[model samples]
Target: MSGIMKISDKEFYSLRSLILEHFGINIQEQKRTLLVVRLQKLLQAQGFKTFREYYNYLIRDSSPDRLHELIDSISTNFSFFFREHKHFDYLSKTVLPLLVERQKKRNSKNIRIWSAGCSTGEEPYTIVMLMLEFFGIEYAMWNAGVLATDISTRALKKAMKGIYSQDKIRHVPAGLNKKFFNKADEGKLVINETIRNNVTFRRLNLMKPTFPFKKKFHIIFCRNVMIYFNQQTRNDLIRKFHNVSKPGSFLFIGHSETLDTSRNLYKYVMPATYMRI
Candidate 1:
């Protein structure tokens, strides 16, 4: 009898607030109806006929999965292979060349990169392929690994599998397809385990005070993840990303985002992209 649930205004407001606190994402008033639609099934699953009960259950249940579910629902996951080609182009044409020179000066060949909110696996996979091309597989002996994280366990699982539908391969380069991807039994493109193992997937909530990584990175791709947060939260997260990077490291954001007002020690390289000090 309690299988049906409807979210009212009060419950919707409270849900929005908790989501922002837990995920650092700000939901606008226009999204109220959308929230109701998404949570309808979730409330039903919890055997609640109202959002009030579901919200209370969420607060009381301190299990990590509950929090993870809340985050997964609110987070945006739109990404594709070779997304925003300009950034990758920039990485190849300018950034990699510059970094090569910088590495020579530093007398070190270590390279570390992070793809924050790497939905599934597209963005980070694109990165490794480009890295292999830039350094040349034969000469690319430097220690390199991508640390990818997302709040969604479901997405992370798929990312770990490194399998994608044939439709998803269009944005990826042809050469990469020939070199790294294979046609699986399902007739879909499956990334070899070698590349998948090279990436370490972890569950990370960006809203936390500190990211648990010890080593600072040279480049971080946090693209499209900030659009969900409010200005203040966005500013805070950007500062956090900046603090975690070494001087001259790069942060790539959504194509439509900018840090003009939240500006700190980052110099603009292009729209929605900057280099940290």
Candidate 2:
């Protein structure tokens, strides 16, 4: 192991505290090893000789940009093409129909969806694929796509390009597999313009000063992202969700998460489902 391999408890806690203060996430005691293992990549980039030196630089000379990189690194972005397929199943059967009807009833054609913490953009693209499949490519009346945002700029960049391999597309449906994508060199699948056409990508840190958007989303999948945050931060995010989400809009959190803790800001529509209050 090299000199940067060393990580003392003091140094670990310092890094942990820095992350918590900036991103409002708390690391459990058991994750110390995970921290050391994961942060190794971060330290290697700086060619720092020790965790001590890196820790001091982050504390004394930390800028907004540095913390952005920290959040991008420290937080887990464990996502696949169509993770937890059941959620999309629900979206296809229950969510999309409701959205279509609601749009027509209100004589509105433009609808919006926000994929918060959209790692590499699979989730939002998945939503777009569903929309294109059900409503057809020329559904000019419903000019809706997705607004995918993530705290990680690196992830957002990859998402905007809209390319993935067979391994990543494992959970995608058979029909969608045949259409909306072309196999490129080396069996990598590229999302055709149909899926990529309307989806927009933005780099957003949820812990920032303001939510910074005026348009209320019809469906916002803030999924699997809040598990890293503390209760207060989670509650704050739910409040923001309420503000940004329309009355009947759906906010999907991670399977392991719930809105019960922040019930005042949301009304339960079903299990693991919520409506903004």
Candidate 3:
């Protein structure tokens, strides 16, 4: 392997601009050293001598998958099952009941949910488990499933595999854990096919100008994903989300993230929760 490829100021700026333009990720000046450290191994493996070469290669690469690889390196995928217990509580006590009532009134059993930026599938799986518990035997009658998406193909692959270390599921409720995961040979827990089948994982870049979802979602969970984006990018992405949400649908963001209620597209239902107007 080549000696650590040094990232000069100009090269760093060039790569920074590329990331901001394409991924909406604003790499602050303080993160310069972190960026270089994180990407050094990838640069060596790809045989790029400098960050400039990597930037050039990224722009010229015809296949979109290369971009996904870059994102996988830069993005953090730290998550656990039922990471935010309150959100699950609100979902079961409020959102699901409302959705069920509305769908019943419409004479439709379809329940649409989108788990945007679902890293490694924990959030979506938690959602599916709740829905199953909510409907119990009637769950089989509804066409309910989660559309889980993230930009990192690497994370999605692990999510699709439905495997996790036993400690990784420590936050999951005991009864749900017993029902949904099978104990594997080496202290690993494998999500049952039933739970895995309820979620569909996809590679989706939230920076896109327009979303191509065929139907508007009843609930959109895009937590913690916007922390990397600048204010403008977050606003723009939220607008796109608004357009793709059904009226009165719920939008769940990270507890640390807040929407500009001044936009009036959605009303504040609770902390980090909004209802589409």
Q: All models: lDDT?
A: 0.81, 0.81, 0.91
Candidates sorted by TM-score, best first: 3, 1, 2
lDDT-sorted candidate list, best first: 3, 1, 2
Per-residue lDDT tens digits for candidate 1, residues 36-115, read 66667666666777778888988897788887877666566777888899999998888878877888799978778899
When 1 and 3 are scored with TM-score, the better candidate is 3
lDDT of 2 by residue, 1-277 (tens): 4533767889888888888877777898898888877778887877877889888778787687777777777777768777777778788888888888888898989778899999898889888887877777556568788988888877888888877888888888788887878877787988888778778898887887578888888888988888888888888888887888788788888788877644676787766777776
Best-matching candidate per lDDT: 3
The segments of candidate 3 whose C-alpha lies over 4 angstroms from its true place after superposition are 1-5
Please give the RMSD of candidate 2 to the true structure: 2.0
- Candidate RMSDs in Å, in order, are 2.1, 2.0, 1.4
The list of candidate 1 runs beyond 4 A from truth reads 1-5
Quote each prediction's TM-score. Answer: 0.93, 0.92, 0.96
Better of 2 and 3 by TM-score: 3
